[model samples]
Target chain A: MKRRWRQLIYLLTATAAALFMFLPAAAETPVEKGLAIAREADARDTGFRDSTVNLLMILRNRHGQESIRRMRIRTLEVEGDGDKILNIFDSPRDVRGTALLTYTHKFGDDDQWLYLPALKRVKRISSRNKSGSFMGSEFAYEDIASQEVEKYTYKWIRDEVYDGLECFVIERYPLDRKNSGYRRQMIWIDKKEYRTLKVDYYDRKDSLLKTLTLTGYRKYNNRFWRASGMNMVNHQNGKSTRLEFSDYRFGVGLRDSDFSRNSLKRVR
Target chain B: MGRPAYASAAVPLALVLLLVFFVSRSQACDLSGHASVEGRFFFRDALFPGQEGNSASVALQPEFYHGRRDGSGLTFTPFARFDSADPERSRFDIRELNYLMLGDHWELTVGISRVFWGVTEFVHLADIINQTDYVEDMDGEDKLGQPMIHLSMPRDWGVVDMFVLPYFRERTFPGEKGRLRTQPVVDTDRAVYESAAKEYHVDLALRYSHTAGIWDFGIYYFRGTGREPDFLLSADSSGKPVLVPFYVQIGQTGLDVQAVLGNWLFKLESIYRTSRDRNFFAGAGGFEYSMVNAASSGVDAGLIAEWAYDERGEDASTPFDNDVVLGIRLALNDAAGTEALIGISRDLDGGDSMLSLESGRRIGEAWKIALDAFFVIGSSEGDALHALRADDNVQVRLSYYF
Candidate 1:
């Protein structure tokens, strides 16, 4: 009986020791760490319901020429799927009253519609053109869409400081390689808020193409964090775009119907 | 003459009164407007006797809206344009003077408004709501807003819209001095109407539309005076051979569908129309495939091909009957918003063809420049476009938007 007890204790000790060693080893791997961080960030961003924001985009060329565009964005979050977004332009008189509707999916391609006020018609835009610039801005269609966690695979690099704040430096590779313009992206996310602070995009040739920086983050509804300004600079072209956001309203009772094609024409 | 003058003055007086009432009563009313000045220069000389080689125009479009947060609104949009070269093109229209009320499952609109329905790129075979403003452009995209009471109801199946058109609008035509015209000028003052009610004939339209997955479908029916007029060769008071437009009653049924799959878009538009003179069917089907970021650049290029068919064969009103169109579109994806498109339509019955090129780019912030070129070649003598075969021209337009 004593030998039996001794054997059982030995087995318990061996199992505990194995777990102690394996847990740290698994946590030390960058892939696992990165996935955990992404999951946490995604969880923290859930349940936003809906949000509306006004944006002013300033574009600058290599010669320092500047132009400005104004638009409004409305978003509705869907559980277990991607979000629905509506964008309405309010400036540059010619494109005024133009609206774009997007329905993103967690997997596969997204659906997009462009309503041209001049033609008084809604055209179905190819969502495969996600890599193309949006409305002459430096931002691509994918950049403005609600980023889905499943669209990429993540790998944690190291902990670093960005803008004087502690951040988790991670790398993410787009899962839809053919449609994505970037080969990979390195992101710096703040530790406390899990809000993205900076991102560096690498081209298909694995060369640095653009860098995006976010600043002036403000908390909304005591839970959601939003950046007030974003700047994207193209390394090759020496051109840049700055987005300034204002007039954010949350939980405004936006429903699925409000994001429909019918509502696109009615958007003021 | 006295009654007509009074009726003309009453419209403006009523509009002014409505504007005053809305502004005084609704605190949430918003008023906005935009003015554009455009200059168009044609490369070719005048094709007709009284036509000019260049023109300048100014347009003002103002909108007034009074609404609450619940989507109930009264909107008035007044559009006016003055052309220096073509008096017939200079006009004023109440584009949308309507009262809109919305509910959870239904919406209602009353007054003058515009509705467009079609999917194909080469031709809009299913669009039949508004009368064509022919003098505005040859593409048949510009429309004169129609006076109607529209009601739409949304259900699990689809959205159903019913329109009660209270009046008919005469299709406008190019003047004698216009660049694009027939062999004989059309006498708009002597137009004939099939219905004794004339312009007072009430029309009706119904449409059901729905979208599923990547496909959108619509079915429509319209019963009214046909917008396309059949001409009768007659002599005017001056003893000149003139085309007298005859507006006939028609019943039309239409279908439009679009499917978006990956980088490809397929569209189809079909219509069947019947009139006292003849019954016929027309259709247009096409596809557009795009290559995003072609050759590692930010430019997007799209290839478009479409087939258009009409049952009337050689007797069809337009030259596009039984034709095929192929085109390419290029989007620069630059800060200047540059885009260009080139298309060619070849008539299947003959070797006749029409080639068109359109390009536009923004200048700085408020200015835009557009270039358009059209060439008609090898047209048969009997073809409608044969009259203006030498009218091939290139136009450059510069516009300032505010």
Candidate 2:
């Protein structure tokens, strides 16, 4: 009996020593881990040009009623810190020779240009408000473009489970002093892929304003993850906007020369 | 090859309905509406040309509404003005009384509203019906108050709207101590010289909007004549015209399109109008009646490239119409409404160009103060400037919003 007790005590001591060595490491805060994961994911694909196609439908509320109006478009994206996006329309209303180009920067301001086929002219657009709805739709101009890491000051909030996967919740606040439609945003980043699965936006008064969801992430190139669709629902206005991205191709020989102001005039 | 900016009324009523439902409900019900008062106390620098005059004006703008935004709301807005520079111009203006449904997509509004029309360097929309031209210093003229009805629906697929503005009444009250000139009336084109006793008028418009791909197309049509009141005419004691109606139109039609794809933006607009009789200073009779048949069409396109010095760039909340515009606008963080804009434009006619510099600052969030100094370079005969018979006009203005 004494020998058995001695053996049990010895086993207990070894188990306690092993746990003592691993507990502190397992107790790392979610915020620190989330930030590190996001940083690493952003670094993996820092520079690339992508081409995509999308089917667009603008549903307007006329007299409080809704309907679906269809449109198709092709897009070219050059991502740095901010993203440079160009969209060309196809099908419906026969606006065959129209082009829209947007250059979005991370810390500075964004710029837009349009080419008209009938007049053969190009115009430059200013980027003053990123919060204003895009083309009167629920999605703002800022919502459609690239989201840089520096636009907001992030704080790690907590760890939670979403869609059966572990996630880190982070709060992001705009560093800008301009009047904003929202105050802060809470995002849920997946721990595994670092994909943003959901976001809750607060208004200037810190009231919950809107919710955005990114769904259907598909793994690309064995390491890259991309969201197939995104949706934003305005809590105050009871309106929602959805974006579907398709036919994405990566690593095209797109150059900065393709994104010049003079190119707006020559767009076909 | 495209429709003019002033095409037929293609804005659907559904769009207005959506707008009424969403915008009115965005803010929780407070007092429904509020009152705003503002004045511009200008101290003219006598050393400057054309600006050697000082002026002060006091204005009382009140807005009132009844009923909850969820169901039935009726809003009324009225304005009263007193000016030291023009004591003869003391007046009261009825801005609007717009009514909307609780949860539906429809609204009925009565009073004066700016009609959505025209696209030059700036945007001019219908239903923005307050007058601050002399103070704001923009070139576009003002249309006087008229009893009207407006309806709209704000949605995504398409929008429809309709409006009827009646110019039925014009009764000038005698000044507290002076005789009233024949209750002034503006007759089509004849407003330049002759003054009429009072006349009836009517304006009706319809608009439709639809989205196809990245393109938004709006078609609109407006028909009316002799709706501008004579009291507001910029004329001298002898009725020597201080300004002439630039277009000869008893009726006008327009079409406009807005498209966006990536970084490229395109806008196409076209307009046509019916000819009317006009009065001009022909050197002999001071003014003579002449039939003028004319129409003008213009288009503007632009492109811009945006780049960032750092990987993590910035995001902003303000919207600047950079497409088709060539200039720089700077706004300081500490100054909420303060901004400086420097602009240059190459005229579509390949004739003469224009340059404008403007600045606006706010004393507070609710009050905005602005100054505009404009210069037109390479002016030629028949240019926009020479056509308007004006040059280098400077203006300063202040506005308060509730």
* Clash pairs (backbone) in predicted model 1: none
Q: Which ten residues in a row have the lowest lDDT in candidate 2 chain A?
A: A66-75
Please write out the lDDT profile of model 2 over residues B25-54, one tens digit for every residue.
756332322233333332222222222233
Give candidate 2's whole-model lDDT: 0.48
> Interface RMSD, all models, one decimal each?
1.4, 19.2
lDDT per residue (tens digit) for residues B1-402 in model 1: 001121255764686588779878988988766676666655567655777666777888788888878877877887888888777778777777778888998889887778889987767678888887777777778887788899988776788999998777777776666667786877777888999988778999999999888899999999998888889999889898888888899999999999989899999999899998889999999999999878878898999999999998777776778899999999998877899999999888886888888898888777788888878866987776777677787767676665
The TM-score obtained by model 2 is 0.44
lDDT of 1 by residue, A1-268 (tens): 9999999999999999999989887656898788778888899989999999999999999998888899999999999999999999987666778999999999988888899876678888889757888888788887888799899999999999888999999999999998899999999999998999999999889999999999989999999999999999999889999999998989999988788887776777
Top model by lDDT, which number? 1
- Write down the DockQ of candidate 1: 0.66
lDDT of 2 at A237: 63
